[model samples]
Target: MIRPGLTVKLSLLLACIGVIASGATGYYAYRANRNMLVNEAELSLLTSTELLGQRFSTSIDDVGADALVLASLPSTAEVAQSDDGLRRNSAREQLANVYSSFMVHHPEYLQIRLITREHHGLELVRFDRDADGLVRVKGDNLQEKGQFAYVFDTLTFSPGRIYTSPIAVNHEYGTHAAEGKPTLRLGTPVSNAQGAVVGVVVIDIDLEGLFKRLQNDLPSDYRVYLANEWGDFLVHPDASKAFGFDRGRRVLMQDSFSVTKPLFAQVQSEVRVNGLARPKQAAGQVLAFVRRPFGDSEGNRFIVIGLAKPLDDVLSGATLLGNRIVRMVLVFSVLALFLAILFARALTKPLHSLAYAATHLFAGHAMETLPLDRTDEIGLLARCFDRLRREIRLQMDALHTKQRELAHLATHDALTELPNRVLFLEKLERAIEEATQRQEGLAVLFVDLDRFKQINDQFGHAIGDKVLVAVARRLKQVLSSADVVARLGGDEFIVLIEGQRSADGASAIAARVVNALNEELSVDGQSMTVGASIGISQFPDDSGTAEELLLNADAAMYAAKADGRSAYLRYHDVLEARRREQAEQAERARAGEGATAGREAEPTA
Candidate 1:
């Protein structure tokens, strides 16, 4: 017969092994199921993104093709030449009939027109959309759009090439009939028989209708967002935030999700972990974004589109599987608990001493003297457990330390100990929200150190780093308690100033910042002088959102640099107009040069 001690040990060992093996199997299954669910979700979202992009491309293609057809019509060109009244009248009637018939079939076509470049983009023939519906605009009702990008930009493009305007708040004087309507302008050059571009056939698209087509067949739970090349929200689930440029503000994806910076930077196709949040009633999400390249461009480049959805919707079946596995594991655990209790009772007398020591040891209190002198199995087990507890405590302390370091690194620059881009954006967003609630104003300053690159080249990187640290310290010294400063990498920095009641307060703060940077300073005994170019964009004056404010400030900073370095420039609407006109003029010059070269190459005709 086996000894009683040997039998008890063998039986308990087998029971423990069985429980562990069952747990490991359950754990492995749970992990496998979860991994499978995550993979399925990624694939599903990616597929949906592909569908969304294709649908949008089709819509754009249809619009582009329509513009091209209208532009190519012989009657469309007749509206440009006023020398023949009878011919122009007949062309107008034909064009009006064609436009009216097409608008009926495509209700999203808000307006269609033939505009002549003769009188600075004067509308020659027109149809405008209003609350009542599509109405033909007669003489005097039509207005000049020479100042608009669509008219001016398309005038330079070769015949048959389509030009698109940036999506914006429809602020046309007559569009008061549909005030605040978001619109997109598509135009194709109208050329005469000689191929000389004389005018443009333009179309205005209702943005909401365009979005409706994109949303078609999408799940009800999904929220859609569309940003321009600059990351301004052209379309967002939040109606108020979309087309924020009309309100003199910006709502950018990069401000909300820093990981999405790549989408704009490199025109990347996809980015995971861009930041995910769901409505209260919705399940948790793991948002993934897919960038769709636009067929046409607003200015210099095409736009990148993004889409996101909840994980639960993507992996509906796996959630149920997870719940069932959890239930089965609980039942097995109950059975194992019963077996453990029976096992403990069989060895109770011998285990009593060790259990007493273990209970006090785990509770983190001192234990009474143990029977160490007995030299029995219980005593050996007690000694082993005490040593294990000491080792665990040491490891726990190390883990805690590492966790603290990681948390610190997440929000701060390791070298300067200043807030990084991610943390700065979060703080700025929060500050904007708070300012909105308090009905106060906020300002964002985009600061670029003047000639810091020369210093970096003169002194080694070690000294360059020291100079940055010194600059951070100086910025902190000049800032008020309500201000936040962050390095946006390289020599660029941003400052967020709050509690300002007007733009003047922000201006005062900016002046102080300029003065601070002007002070003499040295890093590592290497004397260096670095001033800053600051751009000021304020809430309610320049922009309504943090992202918009930052963008405006950046634009203003470039203006300051253009004017002269080491000064601040406040954002102005005229600044944007000047920039657009400059870009369009440059494009026009290039086109003219290419055309001249092509003509020169042509043999005597």
Candidate 2:
């Protein structure tokens, strides 16, 4: 290197002053910006976590509706009080159908069960939707679950309230449920007609599915995490780290996110704002979280749901703007060497303003946009960042709206908003599974509106459509919310009655169905009464398969039409046996007639 002269020394001195002044200014500006960004981030994260917690709580409350529905059913009452095996079996089977339908609409459920108070906690019915499909574990496969806290503890609870268990990695055996699933068990006491505690119905919700749904609408950059009251990671971005107990290891959220350790101490639910240190990763990592102390009436926390977004993603532009400001200060200092300090001061003020503006990303204000009128690179960079941040927010909102619509349209019926056939069958299969597990009987009533075609012909399709809608409304009025009433197609509806009940109980429901449809309808100011022909089939007494059960019910409905146009018929094995006997007798008579004719025609007998 050559030796420097006076001019070079002067230039070097100006550059050093510019660098030191700008560096000091940038340091303080960055600190203030980082702190501001962190505060905003904390607020945003805390708000999000609170909203998500409330959402989860709302979902559980909806599930509580399912529990109450199960508790109030007369079939559930039968399962508790009836002495007849067929009646009890039928009621248990019907209860299973109700649970299955509930699970169909709620895919997040892993298992829905009604456990009897007797037999070491005998599962009256359990519908476990496993990989194979909905499976009804029965006999040896259905274990005595009374010893479990969900079963035994719920028995002491009030009939209407739900008792939730600590979320844990599921260790359910047999029936081949998905291993290592994060499950939350909810139980409510089922009472007989006399209000005596009969059994406990428990719903095992798939926590992974539930949380994944909660996080799906969120920005892709956001990190969603969940831990139990004890801080075990129920859900984490890293699939391998989640439910660590299943892998014979402990992965506590407190250990993973150190700042969250104090959260467990707070009695009331709280959203904790934190700037955390991640030793293995970036040292600048910050986290904002909420600790929702969720539990049943028995006491304190059952689990915690948390949401976190990295400060790095939200304040990415801060780093770029800081760099640009430093560069601009140096260039100006070199050019205006005599006025270096004043030049640095002028630019530093704007840079600090940019820093302050960047910190308010969460502030929803148009004025919050930084001054972008400069003719230089710093102004351009700031403008671009502001636009980018706004675009991200808009995109997130659009994504959430679309996702919700798609999710709704996928499972519900378009016409009546009831569950479609696909969902109906899922419910049916679950009911079958539960009935099978409990060795209970259930009934599937196939209701076909008599002269529905005549009504459609007399009235236009629009009137016919209105009639169908009215019919759906009427069916709903008679049936409990726990019952599964689905429209299979035009003029056809399927109702699954779960739990143990006698043939008379099914017949009575079928009669009710026919009576429900007998009402006069005023469609376009025209009065028309549509009668129904209902066919009923009971579990264990009827054939298994969805097709077979429907076939049997359909066959019985045809028989009911033959007996009378507006009537209901209970399926019986004797009907099929009688038809077989009559056919055999006819064949014998034809053979005898053919023999007599042949003998007369023949020259030799």
Candidate 3:
């Protein structure tokens, strides 16, 4: 017969084995579920990204097509044939009509303008409504003679063809605007009936409005970002100042064009590595990235579109099954322990009198009468509980620590030891709500390093990281305890300043920050000067909600960069009008050039 102690030890060992097996199964199932969920999320995001990218491309194409149509208008040709003074007037009327039609049909378009080939000056024919519901026109010339000299020179140098340039802030306009305002200029050679090259027609567009429309297309939980070939954040949903392309007062190409040399090389390898296509049915998790060539040449830049999803969400049901099994095992183990304790108590009672006699005999230094006891289940249970209590106490402490560590790692940034984006945004929303209710002002500023990429490209990322750390130190020193500052990622930082009295008060803080950051930072015995362009938007005044406030602030920040770096700008109505005008001019130029050659040839025939 098994002794009570042996019976108890055997039961404990069996329970431990069962628990361990259950835990292993549960862990495997949890991991599988997590992977599936991640895969699903990534896939969803990827699909959305592709759909959005297609939409964006389609919109751009539409703008181009519309531009082509406007350029072919008889009124545009008449303006081209007329003298300079009459041409300007005719161009104005034609531009107004085009702008009205385009805006009415495609509210995504901001404005339209026409540029002449000879003078290369810009004229503002269409003024779009600003944030405050005011319509404003660009005071610059149509040909961009004095202003947009680069744009004019590029068009003039390459005449009778359509050219697309990066979105740039028109400093001449002096307003804060975001980048990615795609300007499509079509330079058509105005020719006589004999087909001689004469003047050129131009069209410009503001893609910012299109971006806004596209953003609305995305789900609330998902974020849509438009990066240049380079990894710079072009259009981030978060109006956090950390977004935008500013390179030491000059804007760096942050779109797909900004990929690292090595990364680009790898991308090239993937493109040419093999002709083999991806499999139709892949298992587990899959990250699909497609590199499509931009422009009409082999050497054109490639746009990398990636789609990812979590494997866990996809297999949550499987995980639930595992969890239930583990729970059942735990319940059984607890029931067994309780029954063992009751049996142990019942069996020990008979021994209690014997134990008391033995204790008295030991105290008196005399032999005690031995009570004969038979081996039974109750005695075995008492021994089992004794063993379980000892083992459980030993393991519980270590398990708790491990669990806490895991929780910490999930919420904190490994590099900075600070709360990550998830935590920061959570707090930010709460802060915004509290401030809004109190009728206090709150400001969100998105701060981006002027030329952080250049530093990384020139000195390597190690040095670049060092520079970032130093900058972060300075940022912490500048802000108040109440203010929330977070590194969204890379060289971008977001500052949420609460309890402001007015919008100007927030502006003043932004100015102070710009000034503070304007100083030279010494890194690795080399001193480099970088400036910041801050976009400030106040609560209630700029937006009623946190998301809208952030967007307005972000738009204003882009405006600052567009106006000129090392400055700050608040959201204003006039900025939108100017953006529309720029977009319209670029569109007209594209359409006019295509039709000009054909029209000129017809007259000659």
The candidate maximizing lDDT is: 1
How well does candidate 3 match the true structure in TM-score terms? 0.41
Error of 3 at 518 (Å): 91
Off by over 4 Å in 3: 1-19, 86-95, 121-161, 174-203, 237-244, 247-325, 331-605
> Which digits, one per residue and each the tens of the lDDT, describe model 2 over residues 575-599?
8757899999999999999999998
Off-target runs (Cα >4 Å) in candidate 1 are 1-4, 83-88, 176-178, 274-283, 297-301, 311-319, 330-605
| lDDT for each residue of candidate 3 in 1-605, tens digit (9 for 90 to 100) | 95567346555655566566656766777666655555555556656666766766666556656655665665554554553533347555655666666656765544454544445444434345345432435444222442454345434442334444444433334222212343333233334454443344444455556666865866554434444454444454444421354433322222222322333444442211101122223233333333333321322433444333323334557668666867876876676566655565555555554444434433322222332232565445444444454566667888899899988777666555556667777777897789768877777887777778888898888888888777777777887777777776777777888775345467777777888788889989988866788777777667777677667777877888887888887775436657788899888987898789789899789
Residue 541 lDDT (model 2): 79
Q: What clash count goes with each model?
A: 1, 23, 86
Worst 10 residues of 2 by lDDT: 274-283
Best by TM-score: 1
Distance from true location, Cα of 309 in model 1, Å: 3.3
Q: What are the Cα lDDT values of the candidates?
A: 0.76, 0.75, 0.56
In angstroms, give how far residue 289 of model 3 lies from its true place: 8.3
lDDT of 1 by residue, 1-605 (tens): 85676436645665676677777778788768766776666566667766776677677768989999988888888777551222348768888899888777887888888888787788877787777777887776777887888888899999878887776767777763445777777889999999998888888888778778777887777676777767888777788887777787878877766667887886577765412233332236555566665546434444545556666665567677767877887787668767866775677776656766766765445333556566778777766777777888899999999999998899888768888888998998888788889998878888998878988898978887888898899999988766788888888889888784345576677778788887777887767788888888878678776678888989988888777878887786437768999999999999999999989889865
What's the TM-score of each model vs. the native?
A: 0.52, 0.49, 0.41
